[model samples]
Target: MSGLDNVIAAETRLSEVDGANGRLVICGHSLDDLAGNVPYEDVLALLLPDLLGPNPQAIRADLGQARVVAFRQLAHLDAELAALPVTEALRALMARLPDGEDRETALLQIAAPAVFVPALVRRQAGQGAIAPDPARAHAADMLAMLTGADPGAEAVRALDTYLVTVSDHGLNASTFTARVVASTRAGYASAVVAALGALKGPLHGGAPGPVLDMLDAIGTPANAADWIDAALVRGERLMGFGHRVYRVRDPRADALKGALRRLGAAGGMDAGRLALAEAIERDALTALRARKPDRVLETNVEFFTALLLEALGFPRDAFTGVFAAGRVGGWVAHAHEQIETGRLIRPQSRYVGPQPAGRAA
Candidate 1:
C-alpha cells in the first residue's frame, strides 16, 4: 500500500514555502518586501485579485467602512460574553457572522475582527470603543479604537509593520484549512471561519500570548535563564522559541523586534519589560543552542510578538485575536484562490490497526 504521507496533494499556486532557506512568498512578492513597504489594505487587494475588482483605494475604503459596520455587531456579541476571556468571546462573535454567497460580502465578514476584537477589549475594560476614523489608515484606526487615543506616528508605523509582516505565510495550518474548505465550494466566510478555528490551537496562533505569561512567571530577567532551564528539564515546550518550519529563525521575528525597538525608542513602552524580554531572548537562544546542538531551535515570531503587543498597549489575553486581524487578509485571499481553481479537496487516510479478524459476527 502507498504510504499516507505520499497521498497528500501539495498545491503550489495556493502558497509557496521555502522552509529550509527561511523564505516565504505570498502571491508574488517576498514577505520581507511587502511587510515594511505596503499598507495592510494594499496587501489585501493583492491577495483578493480581480475579485476586489481593480481598485486598491476603493477596496480599502470599503474595508474601513466594513469595520465600522461590524463594530455594532461586535458590541452586541461582547455584551453576551462580558465575563468570558477575550478570545472565546471573539470566537463566538465570529461564528455568528451571517453567511454570504459572494466573495465581496464574505470579505466584509472576515474583516470584522480588525474592528471587533479591539472594540470588545476596550468596552470590557469600561472604556468606550472609539469610532473608526475613515480618514485615517486602517492600522491607525485599529489602534485608536483599542486605546481611545490617537497613536503617534511611531506607534502607527509599528502597528502597520506588524500587520504587514503577518498578512500571509505559505499554507500555514490555518491557511491550508481555509483553502481546503474553500475548495469544497464553501463560501468565503465559511473558509475564514474554519481558518480562525484552526488558528486558535495552542501550537499555532495561540502562542504569542504565552510569552507574556512566561515572562510573568519568571518575574525578572535574573530568573529568566533558570526558569527556562527548569521548563526545559520538565520537558515543556518553550512558548516562543523554535518553529515547525524555519530551521534558523523566523524572518518575521526580526522585523517585529525592530518595530518594537523603534516603538521603545519613541517612548511608547515600559522600558523594564522591554529590557527583560531582550535578556530572555538572548539567554534563551544561548541555552537552546548549547543544549540541543543537533536541532536548530531559535527565536520564532512569538518572541517579539509579546513585545510588539505590549508596546501597542494590548493586554496579553488579546494577542491571538489581534493575530486574526492580520491573518484574515491571507485567509480571504487563499479562499479566493481555492474557489477560482474549482477543485474539491479530498485526502485519504491510512489505517494502522490490525486487519479485521475473519468475519464472525
Candidate 2:
C-alpha cells in the first residue's frame, strides 16, 4: 500500500501516538499532563534537551530572545511577506535563518514563526508589526505581538495549551519530512522549511480552518445532524469528525476543548459559540456512529482548534501557519535526533511495471 501502514520509521525520544488507545505522549509526559498544565517552554525543554539547556526559565528567556532576533532579521522582508499567504510568508522567513546544527539556528527556527506569523497578521491588516517582548512567555509574547497589547492571563494560558498540545505528535507527515531532510545532514533551518512545505499540504495541516467552515454551514445546533448526515450521504467528509491515527478520540481534542472551556469561562470566547460547537460535536459523533459503525470516527483536534483559534482572533486562512508555530519545535527536535542517531531515511518500493525484454515475469 502507498500509505506505508505499519512501517517503522525512525525511532526517537520525542513523542508517541498510540492510535489504538487514543493517547499522545511527549518525551515522558502524557498529553493530559502537558497541555494546559505546563508552559510551552517546559515542553520545548523536554523536546530539545540538549539545546534548550537545563533550566526551564533560561529556555523561556532564550526562546523569547530568539523571537526578538527573528523579528529583527525578517524586518527587511515585511513589505514583501505581507503580500504572500501567511504560511508561505512564515516559510520564507524561516528560510532566511542561517543554517546550522547549533543552538542559535534551532532557536531561530522555533522563534521565526512565533515572530513572523503575528507580524504577517498585523502587516496584512495594514498595521505595523509589534516587536517581541523578550521577557514574556512564548505564547503571551505571540498574543502581544499580534495585538500590540498585553494579553489577558486566560488567553495566554489557552494559547500555551495549544502550542504545548501540538508541539510534538510522533512521526507525523511533517515530522517525517523533517527527518528525511535531516537524515541527509541538512541543518535545522532547512529541515524545518521542508517540514513547513509538508504541513502546507491540505491533508496534514489544513483541516482546522475547514472545521470552522463545517460549523458555519451547520449554522446552529438544530441544523448539525441533518447537515452532517447530508455530507456523509454525499460521500463528503465531515471535517473534524475523524482522524487517520486515533481510533477512539484524539487526546488533543479534549485538551483543546478544555482550553476553549477555560477561555470561555474567562469571558474570552463567546459562550453561545461554544455551545454551538459542543452541540455539533455531539451530533457529528452520533451521526458518524450510525453511518459507519465499523469505522472509528470521533472528534479530532481540528474541531476545537477552529473554535479556539477563532476566539483568539485568527482568521481561517492563517490557521496552518499557527499550527507550524506549534509544530516547529518538534521538527527541529526530530531533525536534531536524526542527525545524532539516525541513518539516511531511504525507503524502498516494490516495482509493479512491465518487465524489460521478458527476462523476468
Candidate 3:
C-alpha cells in the first residue's frame, strides 16, 4: 500500500513507461522514434491533438507567442524571481498566470517554464532577461534566451532531443500531481504549479543535477571504478545509476547519450568528458550487478542528461528547471485530459492511528 507501487490511479492516453522492457512510448510513437526524429513542437501536438491540433508549424507559432506572453507577464517580477531558487521561481510565476482551462491559458501554462526558467537564470546572474523571439523554435529560443546569443543548429537539436525524450512518461509523480489538481477542475496554471512543486523533490526532477557532482568527484576515467566502489561501500547513493521504475537501462539514457555523442561530433562538446562518463557508466553497471544481484540497477537518463545540459551551457542548478521546460507540454496535456474526462481524484486512506475512546477498534 505504501508508495502506491501497484496503484492504478488514473487512465491516460498520453504515454506509457514499460520499465520491464525499458521502453517508453509517447502518444503512438516509440521514444526512439520521436526523440531525435521529431521536433519538440511536434511532440506537443502529438500529446495535445485536441487542443493543439496536428499541425506542428501552427503549434510552434502559437507556442512562440505564448512564450512572449509569459515573458511579458513576468518582466516586472525579475528582482523577486532572482532571489528564489529556479524551480521555486518557476512555480511562483506560474501561480501568477490567470487560472482557466481555456486554450490560451493552457498554451501559456506550457510556455511558462520556457520563459521563466531562463529569465530567472539570467536575473540570478545579475543580467537582464533576453526576450523570446517569435520566429525561433521553442528549444532554440530556450537556449538563446539563457545565453543571450543565437544557439547553434546542433545545440538546438541537442536541446530538442532532451525535450522530446522527457516530454512524457505515464503517471510520473509530477504528472500525477498535475492530474490530481486538474481533476479538481483547477485550470492549467494551478495544476502545472502543483506539478512543479512535486518535481522539486530530490527523488524526482532534483536527481539530475547531482549527476554532475558525481562526475566531478570521480575526476577521471581511471578513477571511476575505485571511486564507485568506495562510494558503494560508504553506502552513498550514486546519482543517475538507478531508477525506481526501470529494471533495465532507461531508454531515455540511450536517447540522451546519442544526443551527447552527436553534439560532440559537431565539435560543440568536449570529447574528454564524454569519454570519462562512458567509462563511469561501464564501471557503475558492472559494480552494481556484482554488488546487488537480486536488484536491477542500471544507468538512467540523468547520467547523460547532466552531460547534455552541461554541454548546452546550463548550470547544474538549472537542471530541473530545464526539465520542466520539456515536461510542461505533457503536464498541460495531462491536465486537459483529466479536466475533460476524469473526476476528482480523492482516494481514501485506512485509519491506522490510535482510536479515540468512543471509536471502534
Candidate 4:
C-alpha cells in the first residue's frame, strides 16, 4: 500500500531484476553473458525481437544511419536549447524526433541520446558539435562526438560494456513511468520523455556522477579509510555503496569492474586511479560492515559506473544524459510491447484523507 512496495503493477518480457539474488537478465540471458560479449546493436535487436526484422546485421547498420540522421536533423538546435540541464535538453531534442511506433521511430529513440547528449555537452562548453559518422559503431561515435576525437579500441570496448550492462533492469522507476505513459496510448516519444524525467531524480540515475566526486575528494589510496569514516560519521550516504533493490553485490558492478580492469590492461586508463578505486571499495565495504553489521552494504553499479564512464571520457555532470542514451532503447521497446500486449497502467489507492462527517447519527 505504501508506494506499491512488493506490488506487481505490470507484466514485462524485456528484462528481469532479481534483486533478492542480485541477478539481471535481459531477454533470457544473464547480464554478464551479454555486456561485452555481445554488441549493443544486437542487444537492442534482441530486446525488440518483434520490431526488428530477421537481419541482425542490417538492423545494426540501420541504427548507425539513424544516429547520423538524428545528429544532422537536431544539431541545429544547440543554441536554442543549451540553457536546460543536459538530460532535459536531451529529452527536448529527442521529443523532436519524427513520430510513430514504427521501426524507424524506435531506431530514432535508440539513436537520440547518443546523438544529442554529446552535442549538448560540447555546446555547453563552447565547443562545436561533432558530426556523426554512420560508418563507426554506436559507442565509438558517441565518444567521438563528446570529445571531437576518435577513441582508442580499448575505450570503445569499455563504453560498450557499460552501455549493454545498463540497457535494461526490470521495471525500474523510470521504465515504469515510461510504461504508464505508454499505456495511455501516448507515443513512444512521450513515454521516453516521461522516463527521462524520472531518471533525473538523484535517487535513480544521478548517483554515478557523485560517485566520481567522492573518489576525487578522497584523492588517493592513503585517504580512503579515514575519509570514508569521517564522511559516514557526518551521516553522508556513500553514493555508490548501496542500492535500493539489491541485498547482495549488484551484478552490474562486477561486470563494469571487469571492464575497468580490461581498460587498464589495454593502457586506456591510469593504473593508479584504478588502484585508488580498489582501495576505496575495500575501505567502504569494511566500514559499512562494521557500522551496519546486519546489512550487506556492498558496492552497487554506480561505484564502477563512475569509474568506467570517467575512463571513457564522459564529464561527470553528463553521466545521466549518457545513461538515458543507453536506456532509451529499452524504453522504446518496452513502450511498444506495452502498446501491443499491456493494459493501461492505472492503479487505485486507499483513501487517507479526512472522511466526511456522519451527520445526525
- For each candidate in turn, the TM-score is 0.91, 0.97, 0.98, 0.96
Assess the local accuracy of residue 315 in candidate 4 as a C-alpha lDDT between 0 and 100. Answer: 82
Q: Clash number for model 3?
A: 0
Which of the two, 1 or 4, has more TM-score?
A: 4
Ranking by TM-score: 3, 2, 4, 1
lDDT of 2 by residue, 1-361 (tens): 6587788987889999999999999998899998999888899899988887757799988988898788887558746666999888888878888998999989888988988888888888888888888999899999998888889999999999999999999888999999999999889989999999999999999889988888788888998888888888999988887888899999999999999999999999999899999999998889889989999999999889999999998888889999999999999999999999999988888898888895964
Candidate 3 residues lying further than 4 Å off, grouped into runs, are 358-361
Query: Of 2 and 3, which scores higher on TM-score?
Result: 3
Quantify all predictions' global Cα lDDT against the true fold.
0.79, 0.90, 0.91, 0.87
Q: In candidate 4, how many clashes are counted?
A: 0
Tens digit of per-residue lDDT, candidate 3, span 239-349:
898788999989999999999999999999999999999999999999989998998989999999999999998888889999999999999999999999899999999
* Superposed Cα deviation of residue 339, candidate 4 (Å): 0.7
Error of 3 at 130 (Å): 0.6
In model 1, the runs with Cα more than 4 Å from the true position are: 1-14, 101-103, 354-357
Name the runs in model 4 displaced over 4 angstroms: 78-80, 357-361
